[model samples]
Target: METANSTHTGSHAIKRQGPQQSHNHPLRKDFFDSLSYWLDSPSLAYSSWLSEQKLKDSTKTVYMAMFGRFCQWLNEQGRRLDQLEADDIRRFLDSANPNLPQSRKARTNSGRQRQQYVRQLEKVFAHLSSLGHSGTNPGRIAGYERIGTGSDKPTRFLNREETQRVIQLIQTELDELRQEEKSTDEWLKYRDIAMIGVMIGGGLKVSHIRRLTLNCMDMVEERIDLSQPGHAHRARLLAFAVPAVKAWLSVQEQMHGRKLEPTQKIFEADRSSGFGRNSKTVTLSASSIHRRTQRFLAMAGITGERASAQTLRNTYAGLLIDGGATDDHLVDYLGLQASVTAQRLRNAYARSQLRPAGGAHLSKDH
Candidate 1:
């Protein structure tokens, strides 16, 4: 029977010692020939390095597979482990074959796979640096930090019925407030209605809404201009939302008992000391607006991870897409920095159209 001290040691056990050998080890170049050789045979040194990272078993397998491919590629390029530079790493990443190849021809790696490869290389180079084998972490300088997975969570938007229910609830409350005598508390409700109306009608971001001032709204033109110093959007037309906005302005004027200055913020927190002659006003914070919007959503029976003002803006964008607005129109209307973003939103809208109304799952019978 074989014993621990037997001369019949595993082939991998001998090759695995290459990674842990001295920096000037004679067999160092052979180790880079193909990490898969030792990995498939089960390397003690590679397993130890993966264990030191405290990674999951599945993650360790993925990392080892990617690292093995990289080592093989380096060997093909006649590149030594200690002589790597950032540019060489970048070239390899751009030219490397995809792990899951679709055809015989080598294909470029996906953004997600590229990110994973760079991350694995970063760990490898860092380990080598600690061992005094490599001078610099070329993986980090190869732009791992800048690369993204190129995937985003599906966008969340309300259906037509849900959107109308929320708007109806707001209009009902706004009507009730108009009938009641004006007060400081009532002004907040008016502001919330106007803020939500603009969000749904204009697709403005939370930051744009927060920084809005009296001068930003041209009620006569039924337009909201956001070309203010810090705002990103230029202007957005307000359709079907003019009444709520005008009502809020009237209520605000009466609450302050004077004409509102153009510079006064349109959405400010209700002051405990009534907004009378000399009361100081505080701007409504982003959280305050989110909470207000969330309450409206809860009242309308719409609840989810995305039950906030962003959902309202998303719904607004969906409306524009459904109305046959072009991609360029969306880019201008939504103030999106990239035209690709408009394309993605259009794709999302198309995907939403394929789903059952209100996002219901398909029945098994179908």
Candidate 2:
């Protein structure tokens, strides 16, 4: 083991040291060493492991920051990496000081952030064990019993009236766009309408929407194939016979001036030169879809709830359940891997069915 110097800080003192020399010279051992003076060996080892995995630079940066914070916390606790226990990990997440910096407090407050922290720690411990430096993974134990309740935000879904109003709004916008001369804006408007139709009509996830290609749609069959590589659930077909969907596709074909190739992305990024200008095809991001959906929802006067892609998906599920789809049928239609998820959806559907009764029953009887 190589040692450099030690500096005593307030509660946590960082012991600076050089990483063990490796056969791979270009691994940037010093860069990882600088991430934290404490646990330099493990951090450096993890960096090398990450490099071997060929992660992107942004991903590497996030992992490095997460690991550094964990190492700093461990140093404050006076515990070695191998000395960690499930309780120790749990306490670290549960105990938050009000006196801490705003950023630190915010990070601890977020359930999502804590979940990400546990995942990062798990990766580091897994790597350490692989290198024969550790035998146990406390992070995994902590994750199994993770702290914090799941999201409390109410699930948002469009009702019959709201759904019809949104459909009318999209039609109105498309009609206005069609009247204008052919332009990039006109093409993008059609794309947005098409994207919305697929999301609400097909109940597709944002990831599924982004992965859709021209070949995925079967106009003759009036269905869209959603069989993407590496999806958790089995690939299933979705009906796309809705008039909005047909109109969107028709406008898209007109915009391109020809039939799109099988490999071309169905929903693509807007460019100044219009659709299919350059050889490179850029797909719309999830965030882009979300922003556009929010705008459309506002136009339709929908407020006080999330009106994004997921809401549309939930709306689809609600509509199906109302239409007498069984749990097993829902599992297949929604491409859910487990029946338990369908059960949960069923519970949500039951909750949505409850309504206030009229006061006629409470009236005095003669």
Candidate 3:
């Protein structure tokens, strides 16, 4: 029979390489391509370089692809990337066409994708600046006016019933999966169940769970800390700790069975389905998170109130409020941003609601 030894060497062992395994590596087919790297000036936006510090690769691929196309357009116009002035960059921003071509056009991502592309161009210039390769970053040609997303729809989130249903649905799924004896390391049902459990239960951002390399989780200490990307005072820790923990012991067991190293994916994306375009997906991106939660909401048969993952988080906070937990306690327990939760005011308001169920604040009769 034919073997690796027959094909290239004297050995007959098979390597683990496959279509899925080698798909998501960062260095690319056209690593030296004219797009991501400008021969004269690569990434130059100060912010884009900083963005690279936390930029998701899926988004980067879009950015790089667009940049390549843009550079080619520039070349056709007898211009080079390094030589573009702020005015040149301004022209590109003004040249927006909703029906922009896609691979030449990748699948066109609307809404947030367009916003991020603007950010990426900004960062490209930042990276170039850091390398002393470009003169000025032009991503901020326009002020902070919102990009035209063709809609003013409210951000969707879960309401009271859907939240309850998600909890019940997960519980049901876990119980059924464990009983079926179908939960081998290969099957991965219980693991999936536990993951959904803690995420929905504690209002944990699923992105936080999925981004976990082994280093991001601290099982012995019983805490999970995922930092949101930003240099501002508002950046969140997303810490789930003792006394009121977000993750459970059950989830830890699942993590172990999944063969997840501290540095490996704790929560993975279902890349096999349309849920992902690439394989390095361990969990949903910070962007797709809202959509996934909506999927969960749909499964729970709970559809009212603009259900979203963040809505689940709000429900968690609401439960705390209903359960008489202080807002300060809720903030710390849920790792909320200060701006997002007004601990002092919300608690005072909650406390006032506890005032003897009366319409009048003052009593005329003792």
Candidate 4:
């Protein structure tokens, strides 16, 4: 058996704590398939650590989802796991708090959530260290102890009035656009409307929109099939988004000057250089999509730190909860990696219902 501090030199270097199987484990089983789908390339070190953990399946699922989010955050910060230190872990925890960058006195206590995250990372680093993958355990008790706990905050989402205002703004614009003859501007507007509708009505992420293909939609059934690898939800009803998407598709067909291929991306750069089979036109970059979504919100008079595509998605979750969706159904509909987000949105929706019109409060939680 490999000792705690023992380092391995070859494939056999990283041994399991319990019985060692004759066949080597593939980096990990498909237990973390969603993580693999979200990541450009899943980390072998992460796989190894998760494979050896003794947690229950439910707990493991949550940790896997949390890790996926952490990896995405690290990418946004332009940091790599191998180069991370305890400070980076701390920064990540702080950033995860939506109420942050404000005075400490104004911040809601999220110590318990932070502590749990630290524990998960600690185990990850410990296992990765034994496998000779990491030099430090940034997720150690020091990080955990430094965090302060608070009651769970409800998720931030638009109320009914705000939701209506946004929808009305978009609809008015679409109606105006329809009055004019077809033009490049018209096509772009249609695309944006479809994007906003999918986000606010269908609850898709910005990343999902960036990678969506034409085949993902089923207009006949008013559903979207995101059943491909990495997505937790196989399909979701489009509900109110069907008309917007259909209109956009019609516009796109005219703009592209041909029958759209199922394999082609649904959204692409406005000034794509080409559109042939060998064309190099690509989907809007993540940043571009985010900025456009922000612009749309701004046009609708929705401006704030929360006036982004994610808020639109959160609003969709709130709508579902208000429409009598169970927490489990909300989780599945949104393809959330964990049920925590669904629960938070549910609570937020409930809180919104309880408040009087003039007594509304905004949430710092995202």
TM-score of each: 0.54, 0.56, 0.44, 0.57
lDDT of 4 by residue, 166-246 (tens): 788767777777778654556778888888888888888665676577766767756565642333453354466766788
Tens digits of lDDT, candidate 2, 1-366: 101111212211111122332343344444543223224455565666666667789988977766666666777777666656554665566556444688776445357767777787777766554444423455664554343223223445676678777778867876676667444446677777777777676677665566566766666645455532222222222343265567666766666677677666677776664534662377775557767887878888775444667667776777667767776656655656456767776776565556332111110000
lDDT tens digits, residue span 242-322, model 1:
777888888777776776776677887767655453343466655577678777788888876457665677788888787
In Å, residue 110's CA in model 3 sits off its true spot by: 17
What is the lDDT of every predicted structure here? 0.62, 0.58, 0.44, 0.61
- Give the better candidate number (3 or 4) by TM-score: 4
Q: Residue 42 CA error for candidate 2 (Å)?
A: 14
Q: What are the per-model C-alpha RMSD values against the true structure?
A: 20.6, 17.2, 17.4, 15.2
Residue 158, candidate 4: alpha-carbon lDDT: 69
Worst 10 residues of 4 by lDDT: 10-19
Angstrom error at residue 34, model 4: 23
CA shift at 6, candidate 2, in angstroms? 66
Model 1 score (lDDT): 0.62
